[model samples]
Target: MEGNESLSSAMQERGLTQVELAEAVNTRLICAGHEGTVSDRTIRNWLTGKSQWPHPKQREALEAVFGCMAEELGFSPPARRQRPATEPESPVERRNFLTATTGTAASAVPFVGAPPQVGTSDVLRLRSGLDALMELDDTRGGHEGLERAALSGAAEALDKQKLGATQRIRLRLFSIAADYTATAAWSALDARQADRAQALLGRALYLARMAQDPVAEMRVWNSYAMLAHQRGALTEAIDSGLAAQATGITKRDPMFASLAHARTAIGHSNLGDRQAALRSLGHAREALGKVDRDQPRPSWMAFYGPAELTAMTAIVRDRIGDAAEAEAASHKALGAIPKQFRRNRALATTRLALAQLHQRDIDQACSTASNGFELMTGAPIPGRMRSLLGDFYRDLITLAPDAGAAREWGDRYRAEWSRA
Candidate 1:
């Protein structure tokens, strides 16, 4: 059956064994209020064509577990009775049509031939190129043109088969490819293309697994958390963040663990669990303290440091309504971040404005937001920045509906973001 082949292909791409797939499916089923768990034997039967089709509940569980549609998972729904010839298309049908077409186009990239025999020099060049792309993303917030170029470069590198390369060299290439893919996924998320981001992240996770690099895997999982959080899937965000922490703990990497914990804290805060949020924040701080200065850090993690931590702290504090502490943290974050990271500076400034608003400093908040909004006009702003600014705008309108400064700031934001 086509179902068996599709399932097998999905398992291979995700680096999952049949047993692992069974476990994952069962976990999803339990979460979906199903009564029983499937065994590895059952999964084997399904993948070997012994079982041609799953029951409706099982099919749903499988689709949910894999983040795919029924047809993508090789399931054909039962035939429907004939409908009116002029029936109107539903929103769901339109979304499905777009998803299928886009997914097909994205997967149709042509394979490149084998790469030339490479040495450390080639690896170094690739790393440098990736660093440049990352710097652009940090400054300009993921321009679509730049993202496409970066993705193409990384995809070409990954497509090349290097048979003569040493095991160490091959692993390094895999790690580099994974890093690029993860960065591309982040760019997609910044551009508000969630489906594309998820697809890229799945590939990144597979590449990381091939490299056997726990640090890279942790980073990819953290990216998944960020994407989920952006999409308002708080439970998924929490789960992904915890997974990142688990990987980081296995690798004994305090910096990675700290970032994961900080993300988890934000998830908890968003869920209104203040105590859990505070506990996670404390864990994040403790982990950050344990990062050794003598050890070399991963290049992908260069953007993370005290400034990023402070920004996260501000976000959690704001979520929990700790206006005073949030304002202080936001100021600290802004001071600690360098001027080169203009996007981060803008985001921090927005948070600072939000904190000021919470404290009833309407004039100061309007002034801070105006400056931040001006900075955002220099580039194609990230979705996260726009979302934060939206929150600030809503709060300002609610709190100071008649203020001229608030009205001016709102007008400016509308004009700037409309172009964005």
Candidate 2:
């Protein structure tokens, strides 16, 4: 790489021509919440070093563009206070990104020095503890127990090498988000609470950003957007889902795009955009086809796979009331999923139950949800998974009105929930 040069000239010398630089930088400034107008000629002046800086805001934007220290760029560095970041648009966002939630995925992902022997031990502790929590979950009530279990993981001691560096950081982010989403899944199992799941999963998405991991971030974001379906916050969920698509996962990871499309389908379904939902489903299928079977995937994404394409397609089918297709797809996925990942197997099985019970036989729906009940009961409640079922509960009640049975289940859940 050339020695760092004037921020202006560097932009010109790089692929970006001067006019392009001005436009791109100016647009970024606006996105950064700058209000002032900036022109290409003015940008040209800065490149020629004819004008030190046209504006403080413009200067700051240039600095971010170059990825070089301003001092190294042959210009006096902008004052520390100049062009300060504007307040985040939302308190929730403020905490996750600009403000505070948690950071270190960035530090964790990049392995430096001599890399240590990779072992399952680090993730093992988390995995085993998760196993215990799942084991403790009662089909009747597991979310509450799962919530405590998730909190316990936040305290798990992790070293830099657990996952370190930029690429690994994406994996790290996916893992944390997966854990939280699992916890939320359990919570949603009983309470049908999307908001709670959204908070935790959304935080996971933020963690991915800390590591600058976009692929992981997309999955995390999709996990949370499912909450939108539960809360009837259709627009918000779709918008949130779109963020993943916009982030644009490249490289070999088609699952990122697959997951995004699945969530988009859900959002479109909620908004009653039936065609859009189908379109998104097609996209999800295409994305799934692109995912290399043996490529590394995040633990959080373990719940999803080529098998999920069936479930995802079923979801769209179910939404459109194509009970026959939905039932077949769900059953296919359920059959394909291995039992080694029992936690996920349970959920997929339950989904199969959903398709059968809903489409073929009223008795079948009962049996399937009941079967799901059996698997989910003792299953570890990954918060995100429970969130996935929140709507299932609603749909179950609407279709079956098993008030007494559901109450019995709910009571059992509360008891175990209280125990946890």
Candidate 3:
């Protein structure tokens, strides 16, 4: 009941779908206020728990539909912390996590306290001070950049701390560092930069351990498993994924846990462990059922949805020799995703093409592969699609070597990707 079920049940008991409930809440907003206007996108954002409106009126609107006490949902909506616009966070770590997750840039921050009057001098001060520079770097690079800088900076900062003025000025720097490290490692993994990814992750793990934050620690383990899986290190990936789950396998974040399981399933399939693969996939689906969009997810985990899950299902089915089933799932996932994510569309499409090949649908498979190839060439690696594309390309070459068109396609892929 503490899961997505809470929202679903609340809606059902009230004879409402999420949309209907939100509409009712909006109606109440208009009745209670000067003007009531809500965008569908804003409603979706609220339901997803990515961000919330802090206005008392907005809270009233939410209560109108979701009920007065959010307790039944087993959570208190986190209160908004309004940092002053004047206290602009340093550029480095802020961009790393904020840009990718929230799409916000290095802009002024607004929060509850006395608005910080950040100035050129303040920026210059941090720029010149080693400790402040570490904080700034931690903000900009996220945590990944901090690892290298912290090693050098921490020694100097610590030496002067008791004797001078460090803690008073750079309050919350540790928390910022921890968050940044976690994100930095996460970013490297997305780009398929594994060595750098691992190195950054090492720093993240150490910091998370120091902070005793199991949530962050578990996330880094998940990152390690995912990156390892992408690199085709099956056993290592499986072990790392299992360790991540072990850190906290409660239903609190079943969807993310399922993602880790899905990663393990892929690794198992790579190792030819058919039974293990299927079992892990079931784990993925089961976990997905437990998430509520209204809770805060880790910064690195905001992308999962119907499309990504279906695409993953297609990949898993293909790996286990259910070509027709795989093709069906891939097509469904492709249809669900937006056109802006062209790279993912390509990756999913090629896998479907491979499935078509298995079914002797030669022309269609060729068509699909061609589209995927085009997508791969132009984009800098997409955040999510890069791994899937790598897997597809490697497998595509092995699929229909004797067919002339397939061979041509394979050769072209190799030359284009610099993997030939």
- CA RMSD per model (angstroms): 17.0, 20.1, 18.6
Model 1 quality (TM-score): 0.71
Write candidate 1's Cα lDDT for 50-124 as tens digits: 775677666655654555654565544445633344543421221111121122212222337863476787677
* Tens-digit per-residue lDDT, 301-391, candidate 2: 6657777677677777777777788888878877876655555565666566566646535555545555654565532444444544554
For model 2, the superposed segments whose C-alpha errors exceed 4 Å read 1-195, 248-252, 341-360, 376-420
Cα lDDT tens digits for candidate 3, 1-420:
123345556767767655455544444343333244555555555556544443455554444344233334433444565434464344222221112112223433345665444333432322233333222322222222223233322332222223323343333233334555655565456555678888878887876666566676777787887778767777998898788777753346776677778777877877778899889988888888877778765434544666777887887788788889999999899889766555456667877877887677765787787777676563333434444555555565566557777677766655656521
Residue 26, model 3: lDDT of 46
Error of 2 at 270 (Å): 2.4
- Per-residue lDDT, model 1, residue 118, is 64
Count of backbone collisions in candidate 3? 15
Better of 1 and 2 by TM-score: 1
Compared to the true structure, candidate 3 yields what TM-score? Answer: 0.55
TM-score, one value per model: 0.71, 0.53, 0.55
